[model samples]
Target: MFLLSSLLCALAGHVSAFLVETSSLTDLYPPLWKECPGQFSDYRVENGVYTINPWLYPERMGMYKILVTFTAEYFERFAPNNEANILWGLPLQHGWQYETGRLADPTDETKCGRENGNHTCISVDSWWACMNYYLSVLPFFGAIEAGVLGISSDQVQLLPPPKDQMYFCYSVTTCRSTFPETMTKWSTFFQQAMEPSKSWDDLLKYLWDAHVASIEEGRTSFDDRSLYFPKPETDFGKSWATAMNYIAAIRFETTLQNVTKFQKALPPRLLKPDDPPYFIEDFTDSQNRFLFLLHGLNKMHNDSGHKFLSLFRNLMKSELLRKMANTVLEQIILDDNISPQELDIIFSGYI
Candidate 1:
């Protein structure tokens, strides 16, 4: 019977279709799956119904079926236990195994904000909330990138950046030369933006101040060279500046929220509890900050024609997606008897 149950679980991993319902507006981050190679084939929400393409169609050569049911409260309270057992049960499954966190017990009086949202009342730790926040902003970036690049909105593909475009990460050819030039210059400038040997709080302060300064500087530069790109007919420089500021500001706010959440209560697995303890203490507060800073600097690099956007592109292509999944798993095994490294391998090798 256990074997049969396991087989059923295995066969049921391909949940290409699902109906997710939540109580409030904020409780609306739908479950998602992404196995497709090129396209943003993972998560798309339309008309309040989310679709996660398992990418099991053409490759697997048959229709596959799996059950994905999410209630925001259930996800918050029991995600860790459910994810660990389910993922362990069927390592060969096709969807992501998420293990979200809990604040206290499910029946606690806190009630939090959203009726169906996380019990913790903390915003960032709520996986569904974070996902919703990101999904909301993606369209804005899509619109702006299109107008600035002088291409149709559809031309700006978000995830798995087009296979054809020359990239520093996914493409072996581009990384050899193009990437280094872009990344090196940006890294050097970014280091200057930071004060040497500062605490996380200090570092964050530095970042916020530097970014505000950069925005002012960027505005001036735009005023000076406003005549260069996209010809005078389209007013592309003004559009680009507006779009760039929107992107930068959004990134800063999101990064600040994310950093604050992870610092408060990141899963123990992401940081080895056994390792010096302070290392985890220092980093839980600071890890994702670098990525945001990297992204902001990359934006400046592209706008300035520094070519460093290529390095950022490469890093995303190779590492970002995997890193995100690893983070999800990290929370599950926190302070538990599991080898995170081995589990990462199992995750990478299997689903």
Candidate 2:
């Protein structure tokens, strides 16, 4: 009975979300938002084989674009326009990293990410970019392994940046052999996602499991990369990584619409010194408000033991509960009082 109610509510919420008419970011960022690679030929091709160096921002993003294009069918049951495709998170995150200067050369040794130099270069020196490579490149490989790419693994070659040759794999065989456990998780996700019996929840669970595993496998590899940035950016990285743990457990929606909504919570630019979570010294009022919520969520996550986890997981399945949560937040954002009766109406069932 509870499940039925939640499913109904989820359906309504999804419809309402779609009707909101959220704008897509197509050409907002120059050069970085060139074009999605519809086929292997759109990439660098030589003698019928494709060579892609993911270190270059466009090439790496192309990998994600192709993946999204291929994976859209699996998510068609959820929303129109592939707006519910779980893979949207990968490209959106990469774009955010690029926009926020997280992909730049941290040591200032080279202009790898500078406008004056190779602006779209994914700097090997940036810890954020290195960590993101695992998320982007691995899933791209897994899509091929799962037969979604329509291109054989042998037909494509992935190149690492000039220096960090040991951290990446050039082909599906190399990737599967190099990171067996991580690749297994991701491949299992893509394989299972294609199964007809998989539910929305099942897909989210599989994706989140793979996503977290990728982070676990790749995060420790760049411990020293933290030394490249000042204290503020370093602190933001720690906070952001920890925040993802909370997000992973809830299986945050990675749909195009949801991602658009989620990305709004992030600071539009690079974090500046003294721009703390609670203050608008550098960021806008809304970004700072969202930052406060992140800190609050982080605190509640730590203090509540399994309580926060349980509630978060519960909230994911129910639209009314989500509406209730949003209502409270909306009131808070408006600096008005939250009405308990309104929330009671939203949470009318499963009591």
Candidate 3:
């Protein structure tokens, strides 16, 4: 037992070390990452309207790029070289969405975002793209409102998709008028980021608060677009959204390392037509376990919502503790020999 304890400690230390020690996020990437506008000047401007097209992956990623560059100074105090920037989550998640083919046009109208077609176009017809708009645009909107974008709110304009015009709000004026609460939620995070004497934990709280608010709006925003996909993909969206509440409640460190690790645990694409524990040939054991764990968490949350999550969050308060917890979860997913019964034991009373 003593030997086993030492081995476990060593494993945990390895996990912690791997997470903390990482190169720059821009150096490592998910394809089409070569160029993003780190400056507002990279964007085309005519008549003072800085048009950013979210339907194009690079254009949307530029939004994240500008955000990271502007916010780097603030995060430098938290970690060496600012590679641990909490804002890594935004671009990281967007990269995942793109690599997974979530940015493709769902309507099959013009082949705007398929592998054989326009690979980088983020089709507004895509359910995933619409859902991601909330995450991307709201935060960018926040940064603009907070004066981090170096342009007044009116100067920047989002070019919407040709269709589904009513589903989205384009400019700072329109989005603020439409989704006021969600807009303010993201704006507050940016506001908090600019203030002095803020810690990483404080920023994580603000980011997660705004993140959940964006997810809430996304859940409702794409009723029609979500129908373009089959039932399983749509259900996966629900499960993923449900699981996020737990993550947000925990304020799971959105730092560079954790987000990279977290991205690893996600499905390469949208949830396959086959559900987990049933074996999709394309999915690895880790992906299967991830889906299983997500489903289990979502089920328990529906059974008993929000009560134990606060406790779980408290339990995972420290950064080291959160890293260790993520390591254990990754180990569980990697353990193919482990059965449903064992997973149940692990999730028991997790609510």
Candidate 4:
């Protein structure tokens, strides 16, 4: 009996060790995230990186992060976000920390050598500094899209949404990069679809019709992925329940994958010679819908700035908006304009 008890103890210890040492986000991934509620108890080590998937507690469904922490040697070389609150500040308590395994510049391939080891590859730099450069520098172009090209903030009669919404250009820019060719197609599509309209409904119908036509032509285009619509409910086609389900699906499928890190800026695109990949994950559909909704709200506020916020809040709960989206998809049929070669390019871009 004593031998059996001793073996059981040993087995329990081994199981505990495996749980802590695993690289993936063990049992921390919750289907729905709430506020960083309970104490953060789970921690696992994967591929030399420590990851906390659910982190503290999730308050929202779409806000989880996986954090990675590096070893002492690598931490000394490539210092990542180590402070507890820093990673938790992100949405959904979803984040990761990498103690090591980050290359300095995309051009520099050598690993930052171990502690006290003099290495030629180790460049004197901070991860924060590198991140700052990207977020601050390149993202100006996206701001130009919303601020200069789309509409100026000065003209905006309504106070902007929290920085969480208005300052998401970095994420949009990254989304654009994911499908450069697709974006090119989108640019052309939006250009044609953006013919001056009297109301938001007019703008939505124009784009929705175009999308349906594109799909019929064998193009895998989205219905409302580009947030360019103004009035979402000129025509109704789908039930509100269906629309909510769609939104939930969009949130679920779209996730953030940390390709690289930067301080407060966009990092240099690690995948290519000239580009710094934008950090942060986003739902392509949600980003578009949010943008379009904002643009429409901006216009409404301009026209009737008196009740813009109230209208927006109401619109959030409007069933007509969902019907408009669904009606557009169901009403129109598309013919493909993109050549077979263009399709090939689009396929390559996703990879």
Candidate 5:
């Protein structure tokens, strides 16, 4: 009996450790706001534009450091010294440092200097910035190249830089200008791909093809002069999609409860717009109505307990829809995996 009890205790300990590890992995990618509080604390939505506080970049950098460290630890544990991992990981590490430098002291010329007639740096921040400016962009460029080359996710590989080659800073100004355009082009492409009545699997395939085509046509590249879009390949796409679905599912369930609580807090007449005044006075202008609804919903979210739903019953119109969509998208990148079917499953009967 004592031996059996000891065995049971060991099993319990193993289970507990497993749960702890799993929880840590999930914490690596927390909700958007949770990941970077400084960046999101004062975030305001005005006319669909998101203007973040640049001064908060340091805090964002801090969050990135933790994330990068976790990523490095993951790689070290699973695939130490892997070239592909190194190729991507190094840049992220350097990029964080580079951004940190810019945040720390942007105007110090002595922060960056020349070595072997090439730009080097005395400060770690400047050095990292210079290297990251060149290397950080490569992973993005490499993804596009893989698509163009018809390389599968498993086949994706990057060539190491030549020895003695100077890793100097590229034109950050040019990259900033072109990157957004590339992103816009990809967004349009995805929207167009979804216009056809395709199954979820077909949509994923179409997105993959479109990504390749974009790269082949010189629409996306690492060069600051070229357009660039960040698209995950099959494996990463699947994993990302699964993660998004899990996040959405969890958030959807929690949000439904919150919505119920919000409803209870609202005034009765505002529930379904039975009275014309509810629609005319409160929701005549769509954007204005959304803003107003968001304000009230945010208040309810902050409040301690559930109140009467009738107080803000007008939220049933479209506020909940907007809130759910915004919340989900804010937490995850919009990828091909977010299909109509998936959305239907997530939002069905919620209204």
Candidate 6:
């Protein structure tokens, strides 16, 4: 009787761990599994192993969402069938941190690197670091693209292109080495904007205004020049100058609701050079930088953008918000019978 009781307890523990380990995967796809219980019949199980049949679901979004939500272990289960799938699959399973192998424990000072002998660590994994890196690299690509299209450096400097900063020309000119200082300023701005009481609508409005202001600054710079006209010899020069005027006019004619419509109406040829795919294979820094911008834009347009931003704002204040925003429930849902106390303990980490 004693041996049988011990055996039952061990089996129960094993089952609990299994549920905990797999809960993360299920939490991400609650729409297909949790929300609609009978829909899981679409997936096939063979030898206790589950496999997704691509033919069963004609929509690519479903497959793509699964790829994105899968953990590193789950990703390995699906042997990559093609290079395109591999490219998409890797990022979904593992975010940017995968290259680093682990996320730096922010609480542990030893894990972080100090900046210029400062005691406080400057985390390279922060959003600020990523943004700064992209800003710094944009000039190099801008110069290269200008040269390729036979557009002069002066022409490039006169316009604030997408992914390029408002003061990019100034940075490349008088204060080429002030990237660190600029990054610090941006970091402070983000920190302030993400305060719990800050208004989300106001923040988004400010961003839109800043974007419009940059375009106006570029146009003003272009107009101030003695030679404002593009050379007739090069198609790029004419098209670029024309596009700048169109972009400026767009701000006045369109409202926020019509922004998507305006974007769709723009000539595809004018936007080709700025596309992420064009720069993906250029350099490691450039690739990651472009990908970050692309991902950020997508997130902003997605339905969860407001909720995600709101959750992030409350990250330091509310433990519950942090858990939901960071998807911590997966790690905490360890057993079928979890007490409220246990749930609180799991979520009480750091924040």
> Which ten-residue region of model 5 has the weakest summed lDDT?
225-234
Candidate 6: residue 56 Cα off by (Å):
41
How well is each residue in 1-351 modelled by candidate 3, as lDDT tens digits? 999999999999987776656444445654565587667788889998888888889999998888887888878877765676788888888898888877887667878888788898888877778888999898898889988778899898888788878888888989899889989988988888888787777888889889888888988877677777666677666788877877775567777676787677677876545554425557766666677687777777676666656667787777777767766765676666875456667676673
Candidates arranged by lDDT, highest first? 3, 2, 5, 6, 1, 4
Each prediction's whole-model lDDT (CA)? 0.29, 0.74, 0.78, 0.28, 0.32, 0.31
Query: How many steric clashes between backbone atoms does each model show?
Result: 2, 0, 0, 49, 19, 0
Which ten-residue region of model 2 has the weakest summed lDDT? Answer: 22-31
Candidate numbers sorted by TM-score from highest down: 3, 2, 5, 6, 1, 4
Tens digit of per-residue lDDT, candidate 4, span 55-167? 11221112122221211111222222222211222221112211121212222332432233322122223231122222221222222233323432222111121222222
Report the lDDT tens digits of candidate 1 across residue range 1-351. Answer: 999999888666633222121122113211222332222222364543323321112111111111111111122232321221111111111111122322111223344323465322322222222222122122222222223212232322222211222211222222224333323332232343232443433323333333333334335322433322223211322333333333332222222123333323322222222433222344433332222232344445656674444444344343444355336423542323433334445444332
Highest-lDDT candidate? 3
Instruction: Report the lDDT of model 2 for residue 96.
Output: 89
lDDT of 2 at 81: 71
Segments in model 3 whose C-alpha atoms lie over 4 Å from true places:
1-25, 274-278, 305-351
Please give the distance, in angstroms, between residue 334's alpha carbon in candidate 1 and its true position after superposition: 36
Tell me the RMSD of model 1 versus the true structure. 21.0
TM-score of predicted structure 6: 0.21
User: How many pairs of residues collide in model 5?
Assistant: 19
